[model samples]
Target: MSTAASEPEETTVKQADQTETPLESLASICTVLAIGLFVMTFIFQNYKIPSGSMEKTLLIGDHVLVDRTSFAPPTKWAPFVHYRDIHRGDVIVFYKPNPETPDLFLVKRAIGIPGDRIHLVNGIVYLNGVAQNEPQAGKPVEDGNPQHAFDAYRDDFPSVPPPPYEIQPLGITASWALDLPNHIQNGDLVVPPGMVFAMGDNRTESEDGRYWGFVPRQNIVGRPLFVYWSFETSADQMSKTSLGDRLSFIGHILVHFFDETRWRRTFHIIR
Candidate 1:
């Protein structure tokens, strides 16, 4: 009968509605976000290739889906192997070089393990006194000639010229790079404990441990599982005419919109 009594009922209804709305909204949002995070973290993680370091094996612009759980704890049915036992030839992704500027990730093949002695002779990789049989090595190549020549020149003529410039340009040539009595001798470089040597399949183009030093085992993220998708950019994607060719700069961009190689490399396996 009193108007005040009706006011209390309305207030109670309003409080109940407010509480129910937030709970319902929160539950819905949490369910969707949980599923998305789980899919991205455990099932599949996406990666984009930034360089040709692993060319022919993994091309630029290739989008790969790494199985996060592949090396993780095995299922109850199969529990023998673990991620700790990483073997050679595994394509692994790890934190990029330069700890201060650590955003981009790198992918390379495991070449040498802890306690392994690695040396290069005439562009051939000898591991532990045995020539490694690299079925996937595209072509054998070598670097570090200038360093060797400079060292030799310093030993012979310690007072002539200086540290680096003393070595002549011809000394850096591949044919004459290791031309010393002890040049072909094997230099035993033991792999430091808990470190692994990684090299790219495209040996000539890779800046790996052979240049920058060994990759500590902690930096390793996971092994590459599969190539999920690939997008190939056509030659026209770049400026076709540099004021000399037939096509105009604007014309090339217009043509490239339709000239993209969309399906040539999709779903290809990362060998």
Candidate 2:
């Protein structure tokens, strides 16, 4: 009877070990999955451009790696510590209107901070009543200009004749139906205490704060540190790669593969 009882006890112990093996495996998997999700949420993230609104500075099809912890504190564990403060002219990424698509990120330059009065005169941008001198504004190119020849051609050859031109008769000046410059005159649209005004470099084509209003500080994700990679949208048009073109590609590729990249724009401290 004693030998029979010991056999049953040993069998029970073996069954418990078999059950514990799966439990241990499950625990390991859960731990790994949790860690992966946490890292993805807080450490770094990737964003893809969806529009030409920030053209010349950013373009469609360009994928950027955004450092999510650049400005905000890492998680809630340490609340008092801030990584960095937002500055004027910093190219920042932010959340868009759609809730279903969280990956839709918009990149724009921070123009107005709290308490700033932004305005526009004619075609120039002004901050706090003073006209901002942006040396980077490459030759005031019109929207859908010669560069976008395809769009121009499509517009000109629409299936239906466009609507009749409306004349908004001003006392001395007659306003015909034509594209107008998006300029703000006098408006006390004060950027709330914890909000900012953002604008794309492609002023004419951008749907920015000028359209949808200010961006809350909480919406900002991160500042773009460097251009890890860049491919010219116009490169494919070339017939054959010249020595100069080959050199350019080699340099760009090297930057793309190795270094902080953006050879010409590398180490270019964001102002």
Candidate 2 achieves a global lDDT of: 0.60
Question: Candidates' TM-scores?
Answer: 0.60, 0.55
Evaluate model 1: give its lDDT: 0.62
lDDT, candidate 2, 1-271, per-residue tens: 8998799899989998777577789999999999988876876666655567676777553556676787775667866556876787888988753345455568888988887776554435667767788764332344658543322211211122223334322111112112112222244335568878887777655656654456778889887665544444342424435998768866766666645333464333333
Best by lDDT: 1
Q: Which candidate is the best by TM-score?
A: 1
lDDT of 1 by residue, 26-107 (tens): 9999999999998898656899776677877887757787756554545785465454555777888877544553765888
lDDT for 222 (candidate 1): 75
